[model samples]
Target: MEFKLNLTQEQKLIMTQQMQLSVKLLQMSNFEIQTYIEKELQENPVLDAEYKKNDNDKAQDEIDYKKLIKHLEFDNYGHSSYHRDDEEVSPFNFISAKKSLKEFLKEQIIDLNETDYIKSMCEYIVENINQRGYLGTSIEDIAEELTISQELSQRCLEIVQSLEPTGIGARDIKECLKIQLIEKDLKDENIFKIVDEYLELLAENKYNVIAKKLKITVQKAQEYGDIIKTLEPKPSRGFYTGEETKYIVPEAYIKKIDGEYHIIMNDGTIPKLNINGLYKKIINNEDDKQTVKFVKEKLNSAVFLIKSINQRENTIYNILEKILEIQKDYFEFGDEYLKPMTLKEIADNLEIHESTVSRAIREKYIHTDKGTIKIKDLFTTGISRVDSIEDVSTKIIKKEIQEVINNEDKKKPLSDQKICQLLKEKNIDISRRTIAKYREEMGIKSSSKRKRF
Candidate 1:
C-alpha cells in the first residue's frame, strides 16, 4: 500500500471559536442561557437587540404543547392506556423535613437547663453523637471541659435521654431502649436484664432462645421486642438538616405530537432579549470617529454572540434527536424498559466526542408524562448477565436482589453466597461482592440485621 500525496479539492469546515461558544451555550439551562444573552447585549453595541422588520415575517409565534405531546407518545398496542391523563403526577417535594437529634439537643439546651455550664456540656455531648444517635464521647471527657463531676454529666445525660421521642442521649442501643421503657413507665427488673444481657440475641431475632433463658413466655418476649422497635434507635435524627432538598427546573420539554417526539426549549418563561436598535444606530453614524470605533467593537461581538446562540440551538436539537433515536424505548415505555446505554455509546454512534455528548446533557432535562428526568439518566452501563442481551442495569440488579430477599423464608433467610447462587440461576450472574453491593445499595441490612424470630 502506497500513500498518495495528490491533494483533492475537499472543503472541510473547521470547528471555530463561535462553534465552541455555541456548544457551551447549548449546554446551559434556560436561566443560564438568558443570563448569557443579557451579558452579550450589555457588552456589544454593534449587536442590536431590536427586531429587524421584514415583509415576510410572521405575525405571531405559535406554541402547541398538545400537538408536540402526541408526537412524543410511543406506538400504542391499539387499546392500551399506559399514558392515561389521570395518573397522579408526584411533584418532587424537594423540601425535606429531616431533623437530627443534635439539632433537637441544641434546641432543648435553650429551655431544658438554665445553667450555662450544663448547656455547654450538653452542646458538646450532642456534637459528639454519631448518626445512629449514640453518644460517641465519654461522660469523663464531657466532665473535663465543664469542671463538673462525671456524676453530674451522667445526671444531665439522663435528663437529655428523658427529653423526647423516648431516647435522645443514649450511649448504645440497650441504653436507648432502656430510656424509652423508663419514659413509658414500663421499665422492670426483667426489661433492664433483657436490655443488658439479651441484647445480642434480641438483635439476632432469637426471641425463643431469649425467652427460654430469661424464663419468659414467647409472647412476652415479642411484646418487649415491639416496644424496642417503637424506641428511636437514632435519637439525633430529629435535628437532621435538609440541605439535600434542592429544586431543579427542567430546561426542555419532550412532547409526543401525532406519534413523533418534539423537543421544546423552556425559553418562554424568560423575557425576550435582543440588541438595542437605537444603540446600533448611534454606532453606525459616520460623523463620530470614537463613537464609531466603540460601536464597531460592540457590534461585532453582538453579531458573533447572536450567531453563536442560533448555532447553539441547532446543535442542541441535533444532539437531542440522536438521544431520541437511541433512547426511544425509554420515552415510549416506562423506566423498566430503558436499555443500558452510556455517553461514550451515543458519542461513537453520532461520530462526536464524549465530552460533547456530556456537555449536551449536563444540567439539561426532558419533561414528559414520565416526569422531569435528567437527560443523562437515559444512559447507563450494562450489567453482565446470563442473557446475551446487554440490557441489565445495576438498578435492576438491586431491585431483583430486594425482591428475592422479600420472598425469602424468614426462618432461614438467604445469605450473600446463597443470594449470588440464586441470581446466577436466574441468568443475572452476580458475584458475592456484587450481591453485597446491591444489598448495601438498597439500604437492606445484612442477614444479621434482618433476623427475626
Candidate 2:
C-alpha cells in the first residue's frame, strides 16, 4: 500500500568481477597460478598458451638452476646451462609431483608376505599413524576399536615398526628414536638404556648424570646425545605427507649481485597467456549477432584474466622489492639480523592498504642467498631498546635469550628474570614475562626444567 522512494547519500567499496579475479590471482602461490592457468587454458576458448624459443630457453635455464638449488638442499641435485638437442629433452621430465606417505606405505603393505586379515589390520594401523610418523592410538585402544586381540594388534604394530624409514608407527619420540637405533643395530646398550629411561633427562642436557648412571664418560654421553640429534625425528620428512603439507615454490629469489640484492621471480611456471587469434578473427568479422556477442564476452574474460594476472604479478613484485630493501641486512647476513617490520609499514611504503600487502603475501615465499623463507617471516613486532634509540626485533631478542641460555652454566640455568636482565644489559628492553613467552614459543624449557648435572 505504501510505495515511497527516498534518496540517501551512501558510498560503498564493492569488488567487481575483475577486481575479485585480481585478488584471487594475487593470493594464489606460483604453483596455484600454474594450475589456474592450466585450468583456464582448458576452459576458456579464447585463451592460448604462448611458448616462444626465448621463453623456452629462459624457462629451461631457470629449471636447471632450480634443480641445482634442490640438489644443494637435498640429495641427487645438479643444474647445467648446457643445452642439448630439443628432440632429446622430454617435457614430462619437468613434472615433479611427489607421492604421499600413505600411498608409499600402502604400496609396501600390498607387497607384504602376510595373511589378508593381518594385512587389513596393518592397513588400519597405518591409517592411524599421523603425519609426523607417530601412532595416533594405543595398541589396546586399536584392538578394542577393531574387536581384535591385543596380541594381533601388537604384532601388526611391530611389522609397521619394521618397515623402511626405520621409525614409522612409533607411539612417541622415545619409541621413534629407539626404533631407529635398533634398525641401525648400534652395539652400545647404554644408548638404548638412555632412550628407554632418560629421554627427558637427555633432552635437558643431563649427560653427566647419564654417564655416571651408565658407567660411561660424560664425553661419550654427549656424543650419544649428538647422535640422537642426527636421527630423523619425522620419518615422513623427506617424503610427502599428504595434502596437508604444502609444496612451496618460491615466488622469487634474492641473489646478491655486486653486494646489491636483486629479485629473480619464478615466472617460468606461468604460461604466457594470449588471445586465440581465431576468436579475435571471429569477433572482427561481425557476422552473426549471437556469435559476435558470445565471442565478445569470452574475449572480455580472456583480456580481464590477462590484465588481472599482470596486476597480481606487479603487486607481488612491488611488495617483495620493498621487503628486500627493508630487510637488506637479513638478506645479506642471516635470520638473527632480521629487523622487525609490519604489513602496515610495507603497505605505507608501497602506498597501498595493509590488507593488500597481507593478501599478496598469504602463502607466498621468497628464496634468499641465505635460505628460503616465507614472506610473513620477515615481519615481526618490534620492542624498544633501553639504551639505543632504535627498536629491536623480538626475533633478535629471542636469539639473544637463546645464546645467553646456551652459554650459561647448565647446573645453574638462567631464570627468565636473569635472562631479561642480561637482555637489558645488551640494550634489549624486554620484560621477564615477555622473555618467558618468547622462550616458550621457541620451545625452550623453563629454567628449572633446563637445569642439569
Best candidate (score: lDDT): 2
Please count the clashing residue pairs in each candidate, in the order shown: 33, 1
State the lDDT of candidate 2 residue by residue for 44-79, as single tens digits: 898999743565676566555454444456442344
TM-score of each: 0.58, 0.69
Clashing pairs in 2: 71-77
Q: What are the lDDT figures for the candidates, one per model?
A: 0.72, 0.84
Q: Model 2 Cα displacement at 3 (Å)?
A: 12
lDDT of 1 by residue, 310-410 (tens): 66666667777877787787789876667777888878877878987888778877798789898887776667778666658766777789899999987
C-alpha displacement of 126 in model 2, angstroms?
6.0
The deviation in Å at residue 267 for candidate 2 is 1.7
lDDT of 1 at 429: 70
Worst-scoring 10-residue span by lDDT in model 1:
86-95
Q: Worst lDDT window (10 residues) for model 2? A: 74-83
